[model samples]
Target: MNWYVVYTKPKWEKKVAEKLTQIGIECYCPLITQVKQWSDRKKKVEMPLFNSYVFIQIEDADRNSVFEVAGIVRYLFWLGKPAVVRDEEINVIKNSLKASNIADISVSQIQVGDKIKLETGAFSNQNAIVQEVSKTHYILVLESLGCVLKIKYK
Candidate 1:
């Protein structure tokens, strides 16, 4: 058996994985917990790390069975065949996530000049241009208001 990546409907990775598992297919959907803040509270939500993709270990004979599951779109193909993932790589990802706390995970790839929104705080929903990037904060320019503010990494 080999691990194959399957594309799923938007926000359906976990549901598809569960359906595959119910049919005795071994599937893995890596999730990351992200804390989102609202005016009243902050909540931690688990989101799929790979977005709309799930991994399933199966032989070629079981391909149709995977497609039968709702929300599963198709298998990711490489070189005209289903792409195969090494077990070692999967184990590495699992172990790394398990060893980290929710606060330790950070995704910071926004570049200078990227248009972004202030999702929280006083400027919630306002758009800003990233004026500068530092190790732990962003200096953004609110062009409409002609003001610059530094936002700390969340």
Candidate 2:
């Protein structure tokens, strides 16, 4: 069985993973403990490391079985196919989390001329090429949309 990514409804990553596991589907949802604060007090809460995403191990034929659980929106697709996660990559995440001294982890570095996909906003899911990178903004060329976009840092 290969590992695949599942996109879930907002704030439902843990729930979907739990339900899938109850149904005998092997799943993983990496979580981190974060300190949350309110006017009165502060509390530690576990939050999904990757929002709206859960990883599952399943065969190609059994892909649809995950739909039996609610909150699972669909499989994340890349290059016109369901995105597959190698077992080693999963292990890296697991091991890094286990290491107490590690304070932060960055997924990747975006450089000029790199091809990237926008994850949110008006260009959501659209692919673009990095034209220029600045301290406050990025100039990207969206070939699919036939336009250049300048995203400024907030």
Candidate 3:
């Protein structure tokens, strides 16, 4: 068995995992509860560490089990094929998710035309290109969106 990455519909990682598990397929959805505070209140809510993505451990002999799960948009790919999830990368993400208060953050200092790299927190090792800057965030361009988006900072 090997770990495979799957792209899921927006906010559907948990749902997909639940369905997959009910059918007897092993699924892993790493999550953390964030303490979000408003002017006078605080509450904890669970959120997926990786947006729109989930990981599954599938045996090469049972790959079909993956296709049966709902909300699975597709597998991460390169050159029109499924991509393999590196053991090391999965280890890092798993270790990071185990820790709490994962620094709710969004890069806003970076402008639409500026370049930025994660300086701290969960995203520290990844690089995302900025497309637009909002009062509270930096809009990142997704390969599919062909543009940018705003993400709020902690």
Q: Highest TM-score: give the candidate number.
A: 2
TM-score of each: 0.64, 0.68, 0.58
lDDT of 3: 0.68
Q: lDDT tens string, model 1, 1-154?
A: 8888898999999899899999999999988788999999999999987778898999988688887899999888767888787775567457645753322322268788888875544444556788888777657776543346554554
Q: Pick the candidate with the highest lDDT.
A: 2
Worst 10 residues of 3 by lDDT: 142-151
Residue-by-residue lDDT tens digits, candidate 3, 61-143: 88766778789988876557666565555664665566554445555445666556666765455445777666655556533
lDDT of 2 at 154: 52
Give candidate 1 misplaced runs (Cα > 4 Å). Answer: 101-154
Candidate 3 TM-score over all chains jointly:
0.58
Q: Candidate 1, which ten residues in sequence have the lowest lDDT sum?
A: 99-108
Per candidate, the number of residue pairs that clash is 0, 0, 2
> What's the lDDT for all of these models?
0.75, 0.78, 0.68
Candidate 2 local lDDT, residue 28: 96
Q: In model 2, what are the clashing residue pairs, if there are any?
A: none
